[model samples]
Target: MVVEAKNTTSPHNMNQVDVNSDDRRDEQVPLLLQYWQAVSRYRIGIACIVLGTIALGIIVTLLMTPYYTATSRIEINRNQDKVTNVEGLEAEDVGQNLEFYQTQYALLEARSLADRVVRSENLATGDAFFQTFNVDPDENGIISGSDSRQSSEDRRRRFELAIRLLLDNVSISPVRGSSLVDVSFRSPDPQLSASIANAWVAQFVDSNLDRRFDSTIDARKFLEERLAQLRARLEDSERRLVRYADNKEIVTLSTTRDAEGSTVGGDTLISSNLAALNKALTDATADRIAAQAQADQNGLNKDAIENPAINGMRQKRAEIASEYAKILVQFEPEYPTAKALERQISDLDESIEKEELRMRTGALTRYSEALKRERNLQNQVAQLKSKFSGERQDTIQYNIFQREVDTNRQLYNGLLQRYKEIGVAGVGSNNIAVVDPALAPEQPSSPRILLNMALAMLMGLGLAGAYVVVSEQIDQTIKDPSDLKNRLNLAPLGSVPDMRKDDIISMLQDKKSVAWEAYISIQTSLSFLTSHGAPRSFLMTSTRPNEGKSTSAFALAAVLSSTNRKVLLIDGDMRNPSLHQMIDQKNVQGLSNYLSGDDDIDNLIQKMPDQGFWVMTAGPIPPNAAELLSSPRIKKLFDHLEEKFDCVIVDAPPVLGLADIPLLANAVEGVIYTIEAGGVKVRGIESALRRVRSSHATIFGAIITKVKSSGTGYGYGYDYQYSYGQQDPLPAPSA
Candidate 1:
């Protein structure tokens, strides 16, 4: 039994799963189709935006004035002609220095260069040139006035304005990794543009030459003044040296040096002589002191140290005294030998005194002469010192004068060399040279019509797309059925194609019509919500009125009745009844009458004559419809109807701002939410679904009403006219 139950329930479960899957996929179809739908609907507007913008661009380009650009190329390098680079005057290492190229570019665009170009080309007064800059030549000229001061001021202003305008038309661009510069001038006249470009280069070269010549002239004048001052200083220093040397009698001489290095010339004779005499005096004084010391130590034996003659005499006296003393011992008192010895001793003493006196006299004489010699030498030395002092002063002054002369001579030589260099460089030509002359352009540089139109087209397309996106964001309407499925996770039951009033009668009478076909699809989709294929009772409601929920109820009931099922349609709205008008039926007896204590269920339920179903119209408008729907009597009425009918369809009122829909939703098996195409906001539909779901109502699906055939429709590629025309006839019965 368990295995049999599993086998029997498996297919049912699988079918249920398939239904859920189809519901999810159907919900996604609308979102995927939205962009393409919008494009199809607004393709004309987008085309117009792009085409209009492109046309406008073309018109503007055609109307604009053409401008021609003429360019001249000039070379600027760190290198220059060797002849022109005298005394390191030319620029060097320009390629290595970053600022050097920048400075050159600045000079190329300088106001001075522009002014020179204007003058060379004579463009200041040219009407054509002034017109290019949008300045009136008459206004730029000196204003006419009686006052001389005002005229002069106006002339100056005019000149400045003209120069500024000239500068604006000139452009200088340096070629990267090269020494070339592109000098471009733009003007309405091709010939003028070329002429101005060429003129600017010529004037720049001339200006460079002038600058170099001026600098050279300044350098020469400065050197001349410096040379004159140095010459005067040199002459003055030489004169002072010569006069001082002559007055002091000093001569600078080349002399050979002796071992002791004493002066040998006659001018140094007295000083030399004084030096010799002083040396003699020093010897003589030394000798005298030695002699005196000897006398003091020797005393009576002084004759032996001083003189030989005195020594010999003293020896003889000594021998005689010895003989006399021997004789006195023999002959007593009157010996002649003793007398002779005494006398000899006396004679020796007398001779010794004389010799001593001679020696002393010689010593004193030598000492006195040495003193005289010393005094004479001292006098000579004093005279020589005075002469030498005068010569020394003269030598010092000569040295100072000689140094001044040397310094002046050095400066003079340097200035002379520099002066020669300047004279050579002053005649040198400029280094800036034109590599290419300007030529008139064949075509105008401005008004690129094709490119401008292309850009305009792109911009316009971008703007149009932005407009579409912004409109889509601002518009919260549920335009596509997929929008409900993707945003609210609700499955769409069907799309009710827009109906013209003339087709309404045929739509209800003919089951073969597109409206009948659409309702049949809705009926089939609702059949899958329950095991019995169709819910016993389902309520249909919308967010607001005129959303066609009542009509959908009538159509669905008719489709179900065509299948030979007993279907009941109820006009559940009591506040504002609308279902009776859809079927052209009388509203005298219906749901409101039965719910208000009149329980004639059989009589109140009237059969829709040709619809193959029964409809209970909302009999009258009620003040308290919410209270009536909420009563237990309404539930009992639905039970009784369900027992009699195979399917029940209730056309409930709009869900928002009312309690009747929520109460009716609670009594039904499932709820069918309806939305108007491009009518109600998605937020309003979501709020209506919220109210129904909060009452614990089962949401079977949603249907989009009043869908258009092309622009705002729900279906994709499902045209009724084509289908009805091309569809093959129903299979004939087998014969």
Candidate 2:
């Protein structure tokens, strides 16, 4: 049996081969190359899109209306007010606050400013600006003669409508880090654009100056009224203080220092008196202390006892004692003279004691008198302090009145100064000035022709690229041979370009053509499929009918016969045989008749004219074609044909859902699988291959039939070169 043994390698090994092949493909081929190839394939459609979009862009650019923009520059002074050299005048930097500059920009585009510009330009009557909005000249604009007599309400409405239109056309932007702003207006008329921009700047400056003047005037008037009120308040405060003091008899006195170095005024008169009485009480206390000390020392001090009465009594006692001593020395005893002397001395001693007692009593009396005087001074000091407390209450009210007077005076002075400064500032010139007036523009700002066309081309290419990618994603048809080898591991033997004809005879007859060249290459590849020489008996089949399987069979047989080899082309599809039609042979006595044992192989085979190939057409439609192909007798028939012919090519039926091809495949040395390019999906090829593989049939390789010639870079290139008179040597197809 020439058929190779079934693939004994495990499913795991086969899967690994597939996986490694996929990994190698991913590593070798870049994503960009794949995209480039796709773009190259579908470039015609993409070019159509780009050209169409560019044409549309050109038309739109021609139809668009042009607009001209005019701009005016103005400078704002943050310290404008400080330019004047007034003493109290200081400038405010409105630009220092974020919201301030934002507000200024807003004001530049304000409705009021717009209204002023409109009136100044007299754009409310029969102007292009108002007419663009379809506003009636009679109702919305103040026409010169007739409509001028419109009502006040009507005039105000027209003014408002014009202002809205002006604001819509105006734009304001501030220059960064500078006190400058750009005011721009866009209009169809260049002159109107410039005029409107200049008018807006002028109106903004006027409005700013008017606001400053009004604020100053209002401040002056308010200050005048405040100054009058403060003066009256000051006078009333002073008058109230004076009247209250007089009514309460609370006289204000000058502050003075007393002997104690403490401040003394009429406010402290009671306190001063109390201090004086305290000093007297201190003195009296000291006197009483000294007198008491003297009384305490009366028994111990000789000077204390030596008063006038005490000293005289002591002298009389001393004389009597001397006389008694003289009588004692003379008298015998109990004498009258001695007794009288002793009695006299005792009386003198009694009189001395009485004198000392009376002197001590006088010291006590002086001490008591000093204490009584100290008590009297303390009582007087307490009464004076009580009286001073009552007077302090009155002083509190007086202090309140004085503070009010001071506050009123200070406020009145501040207001008077501000009133003067504002009066000076109100006469100052406007700080905001136009730096550059708007001039009429020479060119339109919109509907750029070249730029629009460029953008449109870019957009068109983007859309077209997206369409190609999406179509490629949804389309499952095989585009080229590389996808088959990489995705399905099935290398195509050769690619047969679309023949543009239903008859295979025309393609076979036309040598040096793409279809003829493709099959020649296929025949060459068929020689290398087997290591010995070539596959002797191979089955030709496809995933479905009408995919060029029968045509390929006849062509391969013809090419094989050209190599001086006897070839036998058999139509194995008895159910729907097509080989007879391709070769213009009769099917009366063919494979079916031979298989049914009615006719011999020699009577069943037909010979082609001048072509060294034999054809065995399907004789009749059989009821069990698959069963007939599966019988042991089919193998006998193949073996007998192999001995007779150099190459036996069987045209088998489509493989999917049929038992015919797989049974035939099992007997042949190899199976030649054919798929239609851009016709069958990879899934269909895989399913048909699976069917052949299950029968243990060896797949020689695959062939992609009817590939589009453009961008395929397959056998079509060689045909093109040869047809154009180029004799380049083409390489043989690989196994």
Candidate 3:
């Protein structure tokens, strides 16, 4: 079979195909051709996109709601009198205001205030305001039942949430350097918003005052209990002091210079003496350890003769010996050496007795010193007791006084603090105040018809665009000729223009329509792939349904039959046969019946009167269409059709799903695909082409469908003038 490409001359350079120029132009012509092809082919898709966009915009605009906002302002004061001294916060009372407001804001969302507001506003029992603002507390951690089961906790959270929400909507600011706060609120109702904002501020202030009163009452009770205990303690300390003075036989001196001075001085002296005793004891211990270590003995019995007492005795004995020695210096050695020694020793013994008597006397003297020390210690202890007693009495009195004063003062301070907060709040300078009130809108904020229409169009277009993109991304069907070309690597045979325009009918009725000219051009173009002995049975197929496969087959068959040649149209699309719709043939039994059963072919076939064409439809959906078509019987049928008809056009099913196309393709001469320009994705086409290759089907190229044409006429400098909407070919050159 001889095969060829469409119109050897290519459009080049000017970004357009030149019916005006015989040769292809080089400057971006194919791109322009692609653009023109896309627009011409998918005009319906573009229209749907625009319409969908418009519809969406209208619906969204109508359904959206409108809300309004209102606000009030307040201020906070850390202290009424201390504001002026705040550093860098020299803005009157801003620092104090910020601190105070933080505390008060916490108070504003308190349960007490929330409960009070709820009751005072009477905001339950089917009130919209209640529904909007009243919180249903969940005792079981869920909101259920009717109206009255709402708890205080629920109410508090709601109010807090609202305050938070409103606060989000609410704008609060200090008056530059002042304690003033601007308060604002947002709601569907402007008046309600403003009212609720103001109410929160008022309730917060009142709650603060009430808290103070409660604190005071609590403090009062505490003080009363403390006072009783303190009085008892005071009496006990005094009684103890009196008994001590009386028992000691010491006068209880009051306000005496001697006693006061001496008592204090005695305390100082006792401290000093005890310190000295400790020092002496420590030194003695150290000395003993050193002496023992020097002698290297465990017991003092060996060293006791060198003890302090023994040492003193020895020294006296030495003095006596010295005297005896001196007397001996004047006496004769033989006279009485022994007598002098005895006399001196006796004198020393007498002196030792006297010294022992003196040492014995010192025992009482040491006891006396110890007793004096005790007395001094006792005096100091007594002074401590007195001082403690006096101070204890004062403490008891002071505690009692403090409790009473603090109780009353707590209440007073609370009231004062609240009053200051209120004062700060009322100045219209508090957080979140409305600078301007909501006014009735001069125009409706919705139902903008023109804008809605435009938006609807835009929305529709957007949806279509999205669908196009998504379908292009995911749908994976071969819809465009370019997609088929790029993916399938086959020559684009030709395109079929849309028939919805008046051109085709006019061409049919009076032989004067652009559609007629387009079909003729396509029919002429179809000749490129087949001629003389090469003209063979063509397999018409597509990727999926509703992509103009049926339409293309019918149109091409009709165009070929227009030649008055004997043509046969065979519906191999056993799954979906649409040819009957165009031919007005009632298909009770057709190819499926002929193939599967012993049905006569002569009775099953139908004929078109005007076109003089034969058709074979798939009758009803058959269970085993693929098996029947793949059989040797169907192979014989194709051979029989080709022998009789000048041309046989087989309208086949979508290639991806069924095995029938590849099954039947084994018997055909060549294949022709019906491709919609720019309707399908490149991936889908590639997949379909891959499937066809897997089945070993020979493709004859494609039939591009649903293309649009420009009616302008300028034929390669050989101008051919024609009326618009005319489809007839110009008269041939004089023969």
Candidate 4:
């Protein structure tokens, strides 16, 4: 049967195949599992590194000195209490509380505060402070027994050192969403830690009070000087105001004062007089207008109409006139009774006219009196207005002096009040109160064993991962069967484990050995390498010699023969034949003799004793193995062997640095490439494979040989051992 295989020699096909293989691998093997597999290769080294790092951490932790921390908490008020209604020098803005608290926190750690603490505690005078921190006082010239000048200098240095140490060891932590702050101190001595913590709080509070008092002292002095100047200004302005008012004949009547008890404005006596007379003149003019309107009436006035006597007379005249008209109509023109009635009516008319005249005269007199009173009031108002206008002009200067006096008095009063407030505030009350005083801690705050170990473990793992990555990048050998497909873009047939200590030939004979089973699996894979069952005739080759190509060939042949088929194992390497040695046969005559035209192919082939397979050694080493393998005779030999044996496996020479394998590869059905696990680099294998493919040889698949059971999970426990003899140089072509 002709075994057909896909052409994988093209770069495109190779890359496509590699991609498909990688995709399938990615699907089958989880990414994390692949990483784990890679890491497992160096598991021992990683463990060692991790354990070593952890041990180092333990040792260092043990050697470290333990420190105790003590903390004191205090509430800091952003604003102080007001003793009086006077405003303080520093106004507090509600929005600036954050900045205010931040400033307070900064002050808690200030170097000045540290100096105060050191001095208040008298720490610089004693060696106990230095001893608590495990510092040598003599090293820094502190507490030096020297001359007076030197002693003073040493004491100064010691004082500064104490301040520096105090600042370095002190910590300030603010509580969130609160006005509370924590002052903490750390030291090797627990008692010292507590002492320093409490002392820091105490000193900071005292310093705050001192700053308040000092600030008030300056403010008080400034206010005192200002008050003296203002007092003199007040006296001078008051004198000027009084003298101006007197010169202008301006007498004050009423004044207005603001909420601050400062005079704002005042009315003079002339202005008051003018206002009252102007009111009287307006009333008199109204009265005169009413009287004049009554006097100007043409008929009887309202007074006459309302008079009862006038009304009675008008009624009697109406009766008398009626009686006279009746007498004239009845009698002659000169009748006595008619004349008498007319006379009576005339008399009543005279009386009514007189009464109306008297009322009209009275209205005229009242109008005259009202006009005279209005004229007098107008004259008086005009005179007062004239006087008030001149007084107003004069009062402008008086008011200017009055305003100066008012301003001076206001300032003097304000300053006097503020001065009083400062006197009381200068005896400052504490705005910062201690909530919790620090206590000496019984336990050290550091050198946690578990925490150190976990950190060490993580660091060790990081370093180990880096090392693995670098090693993987540097070493590009085929580590497992997956590399054959992933790196070389060739199908992996099977893996044979390393069994260098065992007898490979004896293991091949034993059916139950791991080496035997591995070959059986490889045989099964070879069967599926082509469309037909295992190829009728195939060749095995490697990138370099001793890559287990010969052993693989023999093993496959032996396994194939076990299926009740006549198999032939041919050693195609004429220059370095190893098959005869494996079978304990002499290399007297084989493929070299057949290819050299001896043509006794049957005699050249030898059957193994107690074994079903046959062996054909390279016979005598040929002077030109490449030239001999390239002949058409080798093809005829393989065709003849195929007819005689059911299967034929030619163990060809290595492809690299030799031309024999490519030449012989065409004579077989296909090429079964064998690669030693972790032996040759991927580049070398690719180069070798390329050379073989250059001859158009069909590469069926690849077999990973001597794979470590640990490195690749697919291989068996047994390892196959093989070696190569150095190739003899080809004799110069005969001339």
List lDDT for all candidates, in order. 0.73, 0.74, 0.56, 0.80
Relative to the true structure, candidate 2 reaches a TM of: 0.55
- TM-score of model 1 (CA atoms): 0.53
Candidate 4 structure, TM-score to reference: 0.65
For each candidate, give its TM-score against the true structure.
0.53, 0.55, 0.35, 0.65
lDDT ranking of the models: 4, 2, 1, 3
Better of 1 and 3 by lDDT: 1
Per-residue alpha-carbon lDDT of candidate 3 for residues 1-735, written as tens digits (9 for 90 to 100): 111121111112111212211221111235545444444445588787776666667667767554454545555555433332222112445545446567555555455665665555544323355344344433355445455656676665545554344444444444676556555445556566667666656665566546544654555566556555655654555555455545533332222124212211122233344456556555555554544353443223333434566567668778867766776788754557646665767876776666555554544454455555555655655665565555445444433443444444444444444434433332322233334433433344335668778767766766666665554456444443344344555655555554542233334434344444445655665565543422457778887776667766666676777886677888887777877766677767888887887448777778877656788887877887888886677867777778878888888898877898787666676677777654566677777878876765566667666542331011211222223443555432221
Q: In candidate 3, residue 725 scores what lDDT?
A: 44
Angstrom error at residue 173, model 1: 10
Candidate 3 clashes: the total is: 49
Count of clashing pairs, candidate 4: 4
Off by over 4 Å in 3: 1-487, 500-511, 531-534, 708-735
Candidate 2 residue lDDT tens string, 42-113: 899999999999999999999987878999999877556545555333345454677777778888877888
Model 2 misplaced regions, further than 4 Å: 1-30, 34-38, 76-83, 86-93, 97-103, 132-161, 173-181, 214-416, 424-431, 462-476, 480-674, 680-735
Clashing residue pairs in candidate 2 (N, C-alpha, C atoms within 3 angstroms) = none
lDDT of 1 at 536: 82
All models, RMSD in angstroms:
19.5, 15.1, 19.3, 11.0
Cα lDDT tens digits, model 1, 387-430, are 66666565666566656656666677778888788888746555
Provide the clashing-pair count of each candidate structure: 1, 0, 49, 4
Worst 10 residues of 3 by lDDT: 6-15
lDDT of candidate 1 at residue 408, scale 0 to 100 = 69
